[model samples]
Target chain A: MLKIMIIGATSVIAQETARFFATEGAEFFLVGIPADKLVVIKDDLVARGAKRAEVYEADLTDFDKHPQIIESAVQAMGSIDAVLIAHGTLGNQKAAEASVEVALKEINLNLLSNISLLTLLGNYFEKQRRGCIAVISSVAGDRGRGSNYVYGTAKAGTTTFMQGLRSRLAKSGVAVVTIKPGLVDTPMTADIKKNFLFSDPATVGKAIYLGMKKGKDTVYAPWFWRYIMAIIIHIPEFIFKKMSL
Target chain B: MTTPLNRLKQYKSWGRYPTVEHKAIHQIHWRSDLPDVNQFEETVLPYGYGRSYGDSCLNEGGILLDTSYMQQFIAFDAEQGLVRCEAGVSLEQILEVIVPCGWFLPVTPGTKFVSIGGAIANDVHGKNHHRAGTFGCHVTQFELVRSDGTYICSPTENAELFRATIGGLGLTGIITWAEFKLKRIPSPLIDQEKIRFANLDEFFAISAEMDQRFEYLMSWSDCLSGGDSMGRGIFMAGNFYDPPLGAEPSAKKLKPFVPFDLPSIALNTLSVKAFNAVLYRVPLGKRVRSIVHYEPFYYPLDAINNWYRLYGKRGFLQYQLVVPLEGDNEPIREVYRRIAQSGEGSFLVVLKAFGDIASPGMLSFPMPGVTLALDFAFNGEKTLKLLDELDTIVREARGRVYPAKDARMSPENFRAYYPQWEAFAHYIDPKFSSSFWRRVTASAKSANGQ
Candidate 1:
């Protein structure tokens, strides 16, 4: 049975991605905020055929707690054979635009906290010598847009960090997969008006599960997002800045 | 908390009919975050996937508390074929988890995309209704969150509310999660057979015989067939194939999708007639047999996602009505005759017999009846007129139209069909209401001068 650690067990995308692992009779060390929601996910993973799903309730934004959280999860699961960091807020772009404090807070939760967990897990996995490390970055990181630049900045930082982690651990036999998903319908994006560009969480989740299992280096969920993001990324800065995306 | 994304959104029932008035959506992602039902200034109703064909799952001028993200599996017992899952979990998702463990849904509707909560609220029946009854019959327990508080409902706990909630059309409250039993299956593949019947009499005769041995039975009828050929169509029967069956149960594959609406001229009467003729001649009463995957056996149309787009911009209506089995099937034969006369019937038609097993839901639609369901492209007044005539015949025959598939049944007809609405109304959550609830209840109340 696989032993895995999921950082954001409560989020819809995280739960959906975790389900693939669960059905394979994986054992889980789940960490997320809100104890009740975490417990619900734990029960859910077990129901989906997981051998065990242990919950470690923690506010992932609390950076000081990162070491303890990682240690506790690894201890609880015996030892993690794979790790997925799937927690982050969309972080209201308008609110962040209104205040520097909001922007920093958004970055702290989405970028800095993840970096802390990565550093801790990085050391543990590097010593263990074999494992898959996956993180959910977003296509928004390809190029910042006015509508959600705050979130874009955080995702961009995350993508860059995973890139460095991948190269640094290349010889250590540690695999790093960076997942950039576009427009997934989850509670995080519940407020967004959905269109053809959007896909259900299950679709994106299955992609993540497959990418992690295959140890793909960099991936885009739902495939189409790659072409969409490529077009967006190639748009000239002069014309792009004039148009609201 | 409203954002650019939370602007008032126009939602469509799967059938895309009656044009729902716009409503703001408040998403409920976690049980801990469930909104206070009484707190919304606009009335509230839970919306899950909008898979219901008509307005039963919609709300006009109210907040749609969307529960699609509330999907999660709570418990599973492969040994006993028991599962408890969040209400928003789709049958498709459940199949992914349980099919490997050798369990299957006790009952399933045509589409696997429907949420468990929607299935329960509609009390959807399936081909296996002859043996398994409606989906609600297997729901062992669920959590209903109302304006008052959360209540755990089952047959023995809050029993009346449980009955009302089943087939309650989101009026009772939000079903946060539910527990139900699953039937054991040897494998996910179906050993299916097809035979063409000459007419309605032969169809019924063969159906009854197949019901004795098969776990699933259904028929596809030519909607425009009449007189001697009336109800002549293909009868299909199947059971889950036992043993590994020499082939691994293949994974659910990506379905081809209709990316955009087909033009209105694409499915006219002549075209539908030609298609029906081709289908009718292919089977030829040969009793062809094959071992097929359950995906195709139960949901052939699902092979193409958004296949209803073929009906074009105006959308379509799925007029499904069940005529009781107590009398001669003259009324059913009459329904086919009327549709054939209208020249508006589409190629797709389904006929099935519900057995004597009674559904526990007070508002449940099945009652020892043969249900006829056909699709009609909305031709404005002409199609509406035809359906209205069918309703009169059905009402006189003590038949009932399925609310889940109805967009335009009159309030009087609805009350006539489901007289237990008064008992069910008593259990409706004070804070929960829907477009359909308002259409039937409010109009009926005003008509009575109450």
Candidate 2:
């Protein structure tokens, strides 16, 4: 069975993804915070027909623990086929502005943690000579706008870091995939406008699975998100910064 | 999956589509070409003139079998106005050779850089869509290299394949050659007429009336127009120029300007809105007729090369959605109203009327409806919100957005647009896929799994 490790598996996006992998007859190693929530997700994965479902409770902000945590997860899974760095905290922009600690935490959680995890996995996969690593970046990474520049800055760094990683790992047997999601309708953004074109978590989950299977380096979840981002990114920055969006 | 890596690094460069980056490059020899009947069974994307606006041209990290090297004219029957050529031959190339012989493409897209194969692959339609439909309609026969690499002459012999290959987006096979019914033209010029419409209703009235008299019709709408005048636009109608009213013939001089890249600040709401206002007010409430060259009439934007760069390094997204004409124009009007109210300034908005000509592709993005295309810059959160709202309107209207132009539609919305999506899935080669394809199909597969 294909052994898949999904970081932040308790996320609505990850739950849907776990269900997809379960249906595909694969084993899963789900990692998330709060042990109880992980257990609930684990049971759901098991009930959905995953060959084996295991969970690890760890804080992504603690960079030092990522190597050991990923190593342990890989050991339990026995030769990791794919690793999805999907855990992220969409921290409050206003809160981040008020405290440097909050801003740094956002950065560490969104970019630094993923970087450390990716470096560990990249090394592991290169050594194994066969594996895939998929990172869930956001379309916000395409360009920085005033509305969400704090979050956009973090994602931008992650996306750029992933691009560099992809170039480095292209010749190696390891494949790195970056997913740029526009808007996803999940617990994360439940209060957002209903008319907002947020993709269903299930849809995003499927895209992640297919992207790994196809070995696509970068995927814009909900294909149209690519175009939407394209137009926004193309806007003149001078004028864009003034807009209230 | 092992072959000698012929590293033609430069060939793997950029394409019309920004998302797709070249992966592997292969060179095919035209002298010793094999007409195998099953060469297309493998993951093969039919490459033509490389004029596709997106990833349809080159499959990054995949094989791009360049067909442009195989340019050869097979035959031309002047009496019947039938022209046949290798798929690699472009419309520009054909026009250069045959326009003096009083013939032109029956249906031409905005650009002449497209190949006959690419044209048929996309089932491209021009301003004359209401009258002539798409280029696929004029095609008489084509040779499809099927999945298994067998060459099948698809006209009447393999009729299903013929229809499938027409708008199949090059998924079925590579087109080696094709025969199209060309139209006879008096000269390489067009008799053009420009008219201004005060609002959406007036624009529709003028377009409907002109459709019966003119061979081609198109409209440029001021998307910035708000409130009651949301879809106000300018209508342009044209017909073949008749020898330019007894004037002495002179050699045509083509002006070319290559814009390497524009400063990110070149295109803005202020400038675009200004351009749109001037365009709308220029022909103020009057119809002006003039004789114009074919270049300006067909490809007005061709004057600026790498024009996409004008949107700046960040690039622009093209949103083209089609709403069915159910006798009530409310659906379209409401969409425009939302766009205007949203204050997401989109300057390049084109409105057109699509007739009953059907596309053979299971997931093609055209039907009997009014299609509107707009360009917007990615402005972060606000743009996302605008697109989301647009998607809702399109979904409620039971309309679909063009996949080629789209970069952010959900899988559920995609399914709603293409009900025959399952059939498309069956045709996908296991070894063939792209970032765009993977994102779409991966979501589709998961949706089905659920």
lDDT of 2 by residue, B33-79 (tens): 53342443434455655455545555666666666544445566656
**Could you give candidate 1's per-residue lDDT for residues B28-57 as a string of tens digits?**
778668988777777888887777888887
* Index of the highest-lDDT prediction: 1
Query: What value does the lDDT take at residue B164 in candidate 1?
Result: 94
TM-score of chain B, per candidate?
0.92, 0.85
DockQ score for candidate 2: 0.01
After TM-score superposition, the amount by which residue B431's alpha carbon in candidate 1 deviates from its true location, in angstroms, is 1.7
For model 1, the superposed segments whose C-alpha errors exceed 4 Å read A93-98, A145-147, A228-245, B1-10, B244-270, B442-450
The sequence of per-residue lDDT tens digits that candidate 1 reaches over residues A20-83 is: 8888899998888788888988898888888998889988888888889888877787788998
DockQ of each: 0.43, 0.01
What DockQ does candidate 1 have relative to the true complex? Answer: 0.43
lDDT tens digits, residues A1-245, model 2?
78999898767666666666765668988887877767656654553446677889998877788888888887897779988888887878888888999988889888888888888888888888788899899998898776777888989999999898888888787889999887875556644554447665667777877888888988898788988888888889888888876
Q: Which lDDT value does model 2 have at A136?
A: 90
Task: Tell me, by DockQ, which candidate is best.
Answer: 1
